[model samples]
Target: MYGVILKIINRLQRNPKRAATWQYLKFIRLNRETKPLILYPSYFSVFLILGFLMLASSKGLLSKDINEIGDSVAGLSGVLAFLWLIVTVLLQNRDLNLQYNEIKDMRAASESQAQSLESSQIFQTLEYLEVKLENISEYVRQRRNLIIEELENFSRQNRIMYNGNTMLDLVDAMDYFVVNSSDKDALEFELSNIRNDFTYQSYLRIQAIYLNIEEVVVAYEALMINVPENIKPQVTKYINAHKKSLMVDWCDKMLPYTEKLRHALMRAVVKHGIGPEANRHFLKIFAEKDG
Candidate 1:
């Protein structure tokens, strides 16, 4: 019997909600039990005193006898008072347990909602990363087109010079003159200069292209790694507001070699007397060209 009682107590302790309801029920039972045990006994004591008072009035018993009856009633009433006290104690305990369980349930629900909110935040972060990657890819394509157009403009200018009176190098002369002049000696010096310039510019151009490609890759990685779950929207908003400035900054940081390449191209154009104004006009037109 003791083992069974202990098992029941343990189960009640494990579930506070059930324990609270059980306590409330126990208090109700106590109040019902107290009504009979307290009120009935007190009522009987009152009725017995009244009967004694009436007997004393008719028989003229001593006042001492009446006092003894009063004392006896007081003793009986004390027992009823004790029963009421026990009932009140039980009710207070039950009320406290019920309130505690309500608070516990509220806390559990709040924690569950917080976990769901965190999961939604993580999902949105991944979505933002996907969108940023797509934008970066498009931006990289535009940069590549800009580089190619500049190079194409340079080649077109060289071709125009070759077709005109001035063939500054053998590559240009060969492109235009292998049919007109068979004199191999006439092309040797210009051919050497063309070979040297071509080698140097080719190296610089290749390096610049590779560096720009690396910059795009780094930006993609930064987007993937740096965006926290809750702050992705803010990150995306800033990127969108300043995409052009951000792209220029990324190129500067990741493609420092581009400045040297630009200088080399300028030097080659100047040595061929392409002139600053002509080069500037070509750059403007190249920027306006379709990608």
Candidate 2:
């Protein structure tokens, strides 16, 4: 019988609702303060019954008429009902308090879950941005190498002494040759012929690459504006680290070559008086630098 009772108790404990009810009853019974509150109604009922029996025996009411007995029993029933009302009120109050605490805990857990989801979304966005930045960096690197190779090949094919010399050096040589010659028209004609042989397509490619880099930088800045303020510091730190790496690639790998090209173009415009049509593509870039 004891083993069967233990099994029943274990089963009840395994059930959530039963376990909670059992725990509450155990708490009321064991707690010093709550023990009296829960047991007082039972204690009062016991004392009232004992006192009524003693009074009936002294007055010989148990052997009196049935009408007298019924009146006494009805009076005891009313008192018991009043006591039950008080007990019911106390139990209801306790149940209400428990429900309020449960609700508070549930709300707290919900808020925590929402915050966790939002944090996850923010990090995922950062990861996506980082990936985009890496792709842009890789593209820049590849274009830089290709541009350099094309410049070297052009220099070699033209038999131009390009060792340790930049595009500006070649421009300077051409400018010197044009300025020193007495036959101005013939010199201009020769310069025009050289320009025709020059790889104009490479110039356009360099300009496109620079524009692409500028656009990417601008788009990234705009995208960052939507990042949440609370996490902006962390996001900025991560993005800035990648930006710094990109800057290094730009400065170390591409800047030198681009600068040489810019100077050469400027010399062509200022010294040689290149027409507006020829300078049209570079006008925006030059204007930005000037500003």
Candidate 3:
């Protein structure tokens, strides 16, 4: 019997679950899997007491007297309970330490995965913003080329003319007189008016592009910071506030340029709206750009 108990203890030392069970037999813990061990031992204790009662009636070990049998059973039960309590406490501590180590490893893996995902998101956003900026820059270059070409053509072919009194009119009148031909005055006046109008329009367009680029850069910076999910709400609030500060009058200022760009982009998108074709195009653009 002693050899069997020693072998059981040895096996339990190798098996955490079985060891947890042996410990629970003494500890009476409110744990999920091991608590059943406490109940099994209580039932076994009752059975041992009953067996002692039967043994005294049959004149078995210790003494045939009922009082002596009861006293021996009580003493042995107390000794067994004390040993069980000590063993179980040690086992419970071991289980708790193992659980703590497992939790720490899992938390580290989770943090690493989170960081990798966050790095991926930042790389993608940066690539997208860089491509968008490149497109805007190309558009601005084309638009500026158009304006410069128009200004040159107007200067070569037309003369300035004016009918009213203002600082702008005075400048046009001076240019009209210097042109040296009666037929050129009307054309020059119209050219001057167009140049002034185009200048104002181009200034507004360039300012808007600059502002949008600033917003994109700010958003990219926010994305690159660690723990984006935890800080995203605060970052978004600041980014949106900065964006709002750039331009508040959406009705008078923003709609025309957005409408023109949106229409042109929609046309481009519709032309390449197929499966692998669109995917390949996006990959090529995103991969080649310096984000």
Error of 2 at 276 (Å): 13
- Which stretches in model 1 have alpha-carbon errors above 4 Å? 1-70, 138-291
lDDT per prediction? 0.54, 0.61, 0.48
lDDT of the structure predicted as candidate 2: 0.61
The numbered model that scores best in TM-score is 2
lDDT of 3 by residue, 199-280 (tens): 2222233334434433444443544456346545644554444334432212224334333332323233323342346654
- Clashes in model 3: which pairs? 23-88, 159-188, 159-189, 160-188, 160-189, 161-189
Off by over 4 Å in 2: 1-36, 138-291
How many angstroms is residue 126 displaced in model 3 relative to the true structure, after the best TM-score fit? 1.8
TM-score of each: 0.33, 0.42, 0.33
lDDT of 1 by residue, 187-214 (tens): 3323223322343344344445545545
Evaluation by lDDT, superior candidate among 2 and 3: 2
Candidate 3, TM-score vs. the true structure? 0.33
Each candidate: how many clashes? Answer: 0, 0, 6
Model 2 poorest ten-residue lDDT run: 188-197
